[model samples]
Target: MRTLDSLILDQISGGADAGSLTTADTILVCDDPTGDLTAAACGSGRRVVVLDSDYSRCQRAISLGAQIAGDRRLDEFLAGSNGSAVAVGEMPKSLSRLDYLARSIAGAGFDTVTCVFGANNKHLARSMNETLATSFEEVSASRGRGKFRCLVATGPRNVTYEPAAGDGLVAVGGVFSGARADHGGELLRSALPAQLGRFLDLGCGNGSVSRGLDGDITATDSDADAVLSARAIGLSTTWDDAGSRFPAGTFDTIALNPPFHAGTTVDATLVSSLLDASARLLAPGGCLYLVHNSHLRYRPEVERRLGSVEQVARNQRYTVLRATAR
Candidate 1:
């Protein structure tokens, strides 16, 4: 049998390394297990914690003929053995693997945790490292397999993540200290109306939006993993395909940081659909707040659907739009 390093490196073009493998390490891996790197990492004998946002992937890992471990079953399996674990498919789709991994450790009561993502999840890696650096003793980054790697070490000492000045959205309460909205919790705190009664937080990553709200707020996401994350954070959430069945006129407020891509491809259909959904879901006089990268062409859709849209705030890279339901 081939060593894990050789196998991973060969497939990822020397991007994989065994040197980072440390002893007794509880590493969180949020990657496609079908991918070679995960297999290599698993073979290396590290205490692998598998986390995939996809329910299918989670189910596959738990079945009899599985190759990867489950996320939810990790604590049970890791009770005595030094072998790897799969966290099952309980992670949220809105959260990148890193966020899912962080929330997993926070909930699982692990002293320290590290995360590794494939090239496809680089954006997630960056956000994770930047936001959750202090929670883990060490927050490190590496490049491999056309992806980025994030390693975080956690312990009793509380670490915090802060988005830099001018980043627009700020980190809010209960985010860094193992709260439901640690990563983008502030997005919820900011976008949510103070007197929110029935609302919807679209693309609620890690359930921050729902957690920030006082009463019932419907959380929705196309990513099953994200929906799971919202639920994990105790948010009443719904998962949909973005093609059918969104709660219509069932909310007073709607919010989103719409996704920019679909599996690394520039797919705007999700965002466009969100705009339409927001308009349809909001009661008359209801409001929709959206934060997005400045360059994305969302204004047209928002205007077409809502009759009018206004910019609430603007920065170099991001814009916050608040549109009213006519």
Candidate 2:
């Protein structure tokens, strides 16, 4: 178990009140990719319902005997749990995501629900306590253990659910770049060819790249929240892993602003997998427009996988590359 997970489990299980894990009949887990929390919750002989926005994490939780909140918004799933449940998980890195979770849990109309979320001390913020206080009547923090700390919130206050508002996009918390397009995404969007035949926005967070594009445009993201955000803006999107659900030679033009972070850790494999997928999905003579931090230098990989590559645009922070399939 991660240090944060262990701390959270100890804090909730050690308590003897109604908020104790032993007293609660239902436990809702959020974003537990390792399944450690889900397994521990299930082992306590309570009904475990997991709400993970990431598709891969949802599958992992299901394999651990935790029920998944399929096609249900956070508030909807929490509402079905009858309000007398304990919610636990790792604290999200984004303050907006934390606020969303706190609000959703508070608005679930639970007669009594206590939320226990832990994270590395480095990731914890004073704003998180303030965010939770907006929804719960009482909020407290546990002592640091192995550089991890748990925040406990109880007494849900009645609040209405509201979708997260973005600059021009309707986004859920934790989606990449939130409601606004990042510099890399904007660079790639501007570098796109004038006449894109069939466009595939790979790893399309909030459909920023495909926004306002005409003719056979589709978006796909691994995060369910991202897919929801894209769909809300009238973009056709699929909740998929690197466009794996589509067949080879499916698109004539592909736009990518790949994610480099998996939670707090930088994982280069994410970008590599998308590169391979884009190469496979593009038709003969198809074009790919990708933007990334200049330090990543994806030129060699793009050349190896997708044939010819050229730097189409670059600024201080980002570089846009265009590659053509052989």
The digit string of per-residue lDDT tens for model 1 on 122-144 reads 34435555544534455554444
**How close to the true structure is residue 316 of candidate 2, measured as C-alpha lDDT?**
99
lDDT of 2 by residue, 170-287 (tens): 8776777788888889889989988999999999998888998989999999887788789888999988678989999999999999988877777767799899999999999999
> Which parts of model 1 are misplaced by more than 4 Å?
1-52, 55-188, 242-246, 263-269
- The per-model lDDT (C-alpha) reads 0.51, 0.84
Q: What TM-score, to 2 decimals, does candidate 2 have?
A: 0.93
lDDT of 1 at 296: 79
List all candidate RMSDs to the true structure.
9.2, 2.3
Q: Which numbered prediction scores highest in lDDT against the true structure?
A: 2
Which pairs clash in the backbone of model 2? Answer: 83-110
